[model samples]
Target: MLRVTLEQWRMFKAVVEYGGFNQAAKKVHKSQSSIHTAVHKIEQGLGVKLFTVQGRKTQLTEAGEMMLRRANFLLEEAAKVEAVGQTLGEGIESQLRIAVDEIFPQHLLYKVLEQTSNQYPLLRIELMESVLTGGSELLQNTDVDIAISPVVLSDGFSEELCHIEFVAVASPDHALHRYERDLTLEDLKSHRQIVVRDSAIARKKDDGWLGAHQRWTVSHMTTSIDMITKGLGFAWLPIPAIQVLLDTGRLKPLPLLQQSQRKAQLHLIFKDGDRLGPAARAFIGELRYQCMQLEEVM
Candidate 1:
């Protein structure tokens, strides 16, 4: 007879993830004895030991490690099945997992989510924010349902959103102001520049600030902007994020002497020839709508 119960599978995963039956029981709101029994049943059904009892802790055996890997997938699949069932009864009950670069403000994206929630009340949304390259990698690996990145998609991927402007900016109190009237390519070369080391953007092999003799690299766009605002460095910021600074006479935009200065291209990437899930397709539709609306306003 089939012996691996859902409770046992859940308890097994909790033990593997939480490190012990006691902790897993506390997390899952079950007694330690119940947790132990569930795991024992799982191990017995599989005919393999799941955990090796250390003095005061439990560690996964090779068999346990393998099971732990599959356990996560199984659990996720089970949740999706339940979600699908719920969807059939009411509406789309699945989730959309998206990876986004830090360049886009969460507050702005929240509006999109709000619209989505109203349209699909049963849909859940999760967002993972990272740099452009990291988000792209997550999309490539199918770890996320969608990725908003700043790299043009090609080869194995296809584009969903496009056309973003990137501009070079500096604080008014910074040294770049010295060349306010005489800002030549040569003058720009002698200064230190703050640059974003976006993993995906870097792969484009761009020489964005070729004029700068000294360059400092940062991973976060906000951090780079904060440093620039403090007169610590100059950086390239998206036109929208730096618009306020420019309007308030806090930051100055540099003329792109060469095409290299115009390096950033914001894009939405996904697997080529792939059909997006209902939630994912809905998210993409919202994104496209936002892009079109923003384009008109901009």
Candidate 2:
């Protein structure tokens, strides 16, 4: 028999999370005395102090910190189980939100969505496009149910969907391409570089070379490609994104001495795959099928 109960743990967690017993009581719809009783029971059962007073504020003791960590984990698992049960009873979700990396091939994304929409005419789909850490940010903030990105999120379930190759290229008339021999980092550094700004609201990241003497930071990869195509600057563009331009001689690959192209492995991620709703699962299936269609061409 255990002296500690899940309810006691929840109350204790609520108290710490909400900042005080009074706030916790209001959030949990319990009396302040009940919150106090729960905390007191936990402390007594463990034979240790879980809190200490620091001036007018309540602070967690060392023991409290340890217990709180475990409490949070338990609460998270409980929430997952409850959510799964609810979704199971509900059949299919009315709406599903997904975030994808802006670097992902647009046509493929649309193809998957088109098929998925046809399958579930009643399901509403909300799609968000982000760059670098942007997709992960939306996921961490719980703003979306699923994220497809190259940046692997810390705790999300992930499956590698495909790899995208970014090729360093410049307009044929650009000064960087005028070089007779293979381009060196030092030689390329003298020319202008078009960079795409990471779309993450928080923790924005800089991708590729950031050492150009003249750098033009743009909001999207399309802008970067536009700049490079017009001979305004040079940039590394996803092959699929600029394949037409490359074939039309609007953009030419930089004759770099080494590593002119970089590969980014994109992944499909979600908070909890096992607990995902039917609509989300259906979307994922179509997404994978579309990815396979592209892989065949590659």
Candidate 3:
């Protein structure tokens, strides 16, 4: 038997959160007296003082502070329970909108999508290839159900998927490689550098070193790689994306004293993990499995 009800705890939290009975009443669409009565009932039922009144101010007592923490967990768990019920009531989602960063390997992405589609043939998918903050922005705007990005959303849930290695590379005959010694940052600045533009419209940003005096900013990674292969410029590219070129001797890694290679961690971010439908869950499972397989081989 519980001394207090869930509604009483909710009212108690509302009072603490909104700072006063009157404010909480307005926020919760209840009368001020009802809000006061609810908190009073909670304090009486628990046999503890939950708030103290100073000159024109209501503050929580030490006991209230601890109760607030427990109350938060209680409410969150209750919400999750309701979300699970709602998910069960609805069938598998008909469509899934996913935003994937361009930096991720295309082969792995295609493999996961293929597997997911095979399982749910009726499911429609909208795949957006984003860059840098673009994926996070789509998530924040509720434009996508999931985002695979190096930039994690502060307000959303995320799990690390994999690490991508980027190596600085250029054509074998490029001016930087002609030095015949470990190139310094100063030596590379004189030549053209290929950079991919950030796709985010609102808050665009640069990801790596932009110290080169001359730069050619393109919209796609393929364009940057193509430019590098033609000896138009040098750029740092993901190893997975350029592995074939490296193996074929068409692209050669730059001999830099430091920072010749860097790693970026990609994460799978969800709009609401608890409320995901069966199709979305299946897609996430397949994505994780594929990433695991890649890790084992590396």
**Clashes per candidate (backbone, < 3 Å):** 2, 0, 0
Which of the numbered candidates is closest to the native, going by highest lDDT? 3
* Global lDDT scores for all candidate models: 0.73, 0.87, 0.91
Model 2 ranges off by over 4 Å = 1-90
Error of 2 at 75 (Å): 46
Candidate 3 lDDT, 1-298, residue by residue in tens: 9888888899999988898888999999999999889889888988989999998788999999999999899988888767556655667777899999998999999999998889876678999999899999998998999999989888869999999999999998888888999998888899999999988889998988889999999999999999999999999999999999999999999999989999999999986788787888999999999999888887
Candidate 3, position 236, lDDT: 93
User: Could you tell me how far off, in angstroms, the CA of residue 175 lies in candidate 1 after the best superposition?
Assistant: 1.6
Candidate 3 has an lDDT of: 0.91
Identify the leading candidate in terms of TM-score.
Answer: 3
Q: What would the per-residue lDDT of candidate 2 be over residues 1-298, giving only the tens digit for each residue?
A: 9888889999999889899988999999999999999999999998989999787688999999999998899888888777656655778776889998878999998888888778766667898888898898899899999999888788869899998998999999998877788988888888898998888987989878877899999887878888888899888889999989999998999999887999998989888888787778888998898888877888
In what order do the candidates fall by TM-score, top score first? 3, 2, 1
Tell me how candidate 1 scores on lDDT: 0.73
Which candidate, 2 or 3, would have the higher TM-score against the true structure? 3
The per-prediction CA RMSD against the true structure, in angstroms, equals 11.1, 15.2, 17.0
Candidate order (lDDT): 3, 2, 1
